[model samples]
Target: MPIAGPWIQLAVKPTAFDSDDRGTWLIFDGLLQAAGAALLIAGIATSGGDEEPALSILPSAGPHHAGLSLAGRF
Candidate 1:
């Protein structure tokens, strides 16, 4: 059986996050996610509303390889 672990993330902005593993990162995906989050936060904040930094749990590498991303955002 494949053991699974939760997705780990480091937030570059509210509503965005990054993974330490290469699997989740498409070409420029990380930059986009971070930038998008930043923009979203900035937009919301600038518009005068409540915005919170959020992290979404992406489908992640299973527990067998869990520690692969344990060192924090790489």
Candidate 2:
């Protein structure tokens, strides 16, 4: 819906937008937004489920250093 703002503006009051190629740019913007949404939906719908995700963190210390180790699975 947010992506339709420009289209609505152009339709209701074409003179509001001052861009030289407002229609062209709006078309491009709509296409890009649609493509991005499609990709996002595809990614979420097809995410892998083969492994149970896991994560662990371990603290480590040495003579002159201290750090944490991170391990994970997705």
Candidate 3:
């Protein structure tokens, strides 16, 4: 894939539409993939390979919901 593959997909997303004229799902796919790849690259670039990234996971709850609260520093 090209370095700008995701961006290219997003650029051409408009023309990928069908006759229904709905917004292209490729835009979301491209954006999400791009964001994930960026984050991965950032993490790899910032890590020294010896120091582990800081992280904390705590139980979280609300009136009608409960989930894990994740916090971290990379």
Candidate 4:
């Protein structure tokens, strides 16, 4: 029953490494988590801002052979 109480408390807590000290590993963990979230958001936000290249495909046939050409513009 004692072990079960601690397990239940751990499961109910929001952060596993919660601490009262400001200068603890929890602060660093929070900073790292925020930085990662910011980077992810920035990447997602800027991903669609770039213009895609225009593509062209040309096909040609001659008396003896056939060929295809591909071109693109940024």
Candidate 5:
């Protein structure tokens, strides 16, 4: 099938860039993946040892007045 060629190419020589558009896309995809991985690592590293429960605040607005509600698992 027509789709087989591209799949074969990707598998045979993984680093090969078949065309300029594909090359650019590969580069951008790699950058985004790296960024996501870095953020994940940073988040894990920065989380303190304290096992304190997480907290969150939600704000609601209606036709009359607005109010803030706090939620947590202390």
Candidate 6:
């Protein structure tokens, strides 16, 4: 079978709708990259390799209550 590379890849900034030239693009791209990096770092620091959001609070009583549980992504 033929290989398909990056069927969908992380976007390079200067989104598809942008109209900036290369010079302006680098600055915004850098800013975008920095923001993404910071977000990644924050996510990693919080979840380590387990990316997930957990219930912050649990109800004391309820027939449908599941209490608190892990909700993972990837």
Best by TM-score: 2
Off by more than 4 A, model 4: 1-23, 48-74
For model 1 the local lDDT of residue 61 reads 79
- Tell me model 2's lDDT, rounded to 2 decimals: 0.75
**Of the candidates numbered 2 and 5, which has the greater TM-score value?**
2
RMSD of each: 17.9, 7.1, 6.7, 15.2, 8.9, 10.6
Q: What is the C-alpha lDDT of each candidate?
A: 0.45, 0.75, 0.72, 0.60, 0.64, 0.51
Instruction: Report the error of model 6 at residue 42, Å.
Output: 0.2
Model 4 residue-pair collision total: 0
Q: Which pairs of residues collide in candidate 3?
A: none
Model 3: residues >4 Å from true position, as ranges?
1-32, 47-52
**TM-score of each prediction:** 0.30, 0.52, 0.41, 0.35, 0.42, 0.36
Residue-level lDDT of model 3, residues 1-74, one tens digit each, is 53466567556566654776334555566667788889889877887677778899999999999999999877
On TM-score, the stronger of 1 and 3 is 3
lDDT of 3: 0.72
Candidate with more favorable, higher lDDT: 2 or 5: 2
lDDT of 4 by residue, 1-74 (tens): 32244345445557645455433544465566667778877865664546764689999789999999888654
Candidate order by lDDT, decreasing, is 2, 3, 5, 4, 6, 1
Per-residue alpha-carbon lDDT of model 1 for 1-74, expressed as tens digits? 11111123223233444355443553246566667778867775663435444544444577575432323211
- Please give the distance, in angstroms, between residue 61's alpha carbon in candidate 4 and its true position after superposition: 43
**What is candidate 6's lDDT per residue for 9-67, written digit by digit as tens?**
22344356545465465556566766777888786577646446544444454687656
lDDT of 6: 0.51
List candidate 1 segments past 4 Å from native.
Answer: 1-27, 48-74
Which has the higher lDDT value, candidate number 5 or candidate number 6? 5
What does candidate 2's lDDT look like per residue over 23-47, in tens digits? 7777787778778888878866674
Which candidate gets the maximum lDDT versus the true structure?
2
Candidate achieving higher TM-score, 2 or 6: 2
**How well is each residue in 1-74 modelled by candidate 5, as lDDT tens digits?**
23244444445555755555764554566566667778877876675677775899999789998999898654
Residue 69, model 4: Cα distance from true site in angstroms: 35
Candidate order by TM-score, decreasing, is 2, 5, 3, 6, 4, 1
